[model samples]
Target: MDRSSDAPPHPAQALPVPAWQGTWRFTLPPIDSSVPQARHAIRDLLRRRAAPLSAERTHGLMLILSELVTNAVRHAALLTPEIGVEVTVDPHWAWVRVEDGHPYRPHALAASPERQRTGGRGLLLVQATAQEAGGSCGVRATAGGGKVIWAVLPLDRPTGRPATSPPPRSAP
Candidate 1:
């Protein structure tokens, strides 16, 4: 009697995970130069990983990244020796977080046409940008007595494939 008929079939191979479906964290010196460097690094990372974000989404993410890093460098440099940046991109959303040793959790100011201002609008801009893209932004106090400001944007496109828009967002 042939015994080969009793053998089970081989299991199917699993699909390879995407390169961009994970978190990337790094620290940069709290200095003016780090602002542009952080932006370039993020742009390159998205390009290199072939993230599924549209061009406009990528640009907006970069802008949010820039403002966060710039704020850390300008305000937190006195107490923070290094600024930390973390980028997390899953299938549904892209998240950027900036952490600094300073404990201040800066609040985003509401834009007032009556009040003229040049500076102090970074957080406001970040909030507006994230909101426009169906995302949310907020600040949290870290365990080490620092603060982390984060923003997340949904990666849902209007066409081509099924939209996996993020769940309802909470207040920023």
Candidate 2:
């Protein structure tokens, strides 16, 4: 019998799940100080995610987002009046992607005698934070002659000793 051809397809070939299921987008004017704005936007988005994130994780996410936005602003050529930063967060991961209007490919600067003085530490910072949070970072060229710098942070809550309770108060 030729019944094998009529069998249902395997489910293992289905598309993989997205790391971040919820998405938020922001548009900021092309300016030198857009990093701070990006950080604030990320903070607000993280708050909306309703995760019990520690201060260290929150700070790390903000710093990494700011660095990525700053790198895009400084390196990419601006065509439109605004640049966009897209943030995506899910229960297991968070990511920040910055889009600019330049066609340059993002590259990590190698440590060298001459290159070190050019102030190219932003990418390093992003990479470091991502690794620390058990995640990764990368970049890709956009379709409209632009580039996107992205960094992902794992949302895995730390597992170890229980959190310490506040000390007892003495009677007044």
Candidate 3:
């Protein structure tokens, strides 16, 4: 592949005009402390919105963000000192993306069952969580030689079912 400009594999998302387009952007140093702060920022954003997420949904979203950001801080800090986080939402779903300026390369994070307990399965957990909620998660390289990890999750429970409580049992 003839590469010219060092940019992300995916083109940057165009910021919608007026800035009220349900998008949240965050810039934070890739530090351990930023993890919690990032989560809080996202939580506050969701809370301020008109829609309310079930506790399960909120927790799941936080987990996805935490792992993605944590990985950047722990693994990519050598190349990138700052992390960029973005959240875009619609009626049905919220898309979260974490971008860092680390050099772009395939990240080997899978571990064998025996090794899994020791660690290195953050992405696996992230994928599982997103899948459980009928969403998707993935990574992509940026033009700046960094990469972005993203997850798309529903803002509400699946149709005809509740996330937590089962439908009220009908009187027998």
Instruction: Check candidate 2 and list the clashing pairs.
Output: none
Ranking of candidates on TM-score, top first? 1, 3, 2
Candidate 3 lDDT over 1-172, as tens digits, reads: 8665566555455544332237879799978999999999998888777444687888999999999889888988888878999988654567788999876543446766657366677888887898898777777778887888888777673333333432121200
Writing each residue's lDDT as its tens digit, candidate 1 over 28-144 gives: 999999999999999999989988889999998999999999999999999898999999987778899999999988998776898688789999999899989888888888899
Give the winner by lDDT: 1
Q: How close is every model to the real structure, measured as TM-score?
A: 0.84, 0.72, 0.74
* Stronger candidate by lDDT (2 vs 3): 3
Model 3, position 1: C-alpha lDDT score: 83
Worst 10 residues of 1 by lDDT: 163-172
Q: Residue 154 deviation, candidate 1, in Å?
A: 1.1
Model 2 residue 14 CA deviation in Å? 21
Candidate achieving the largest TM-score: 1
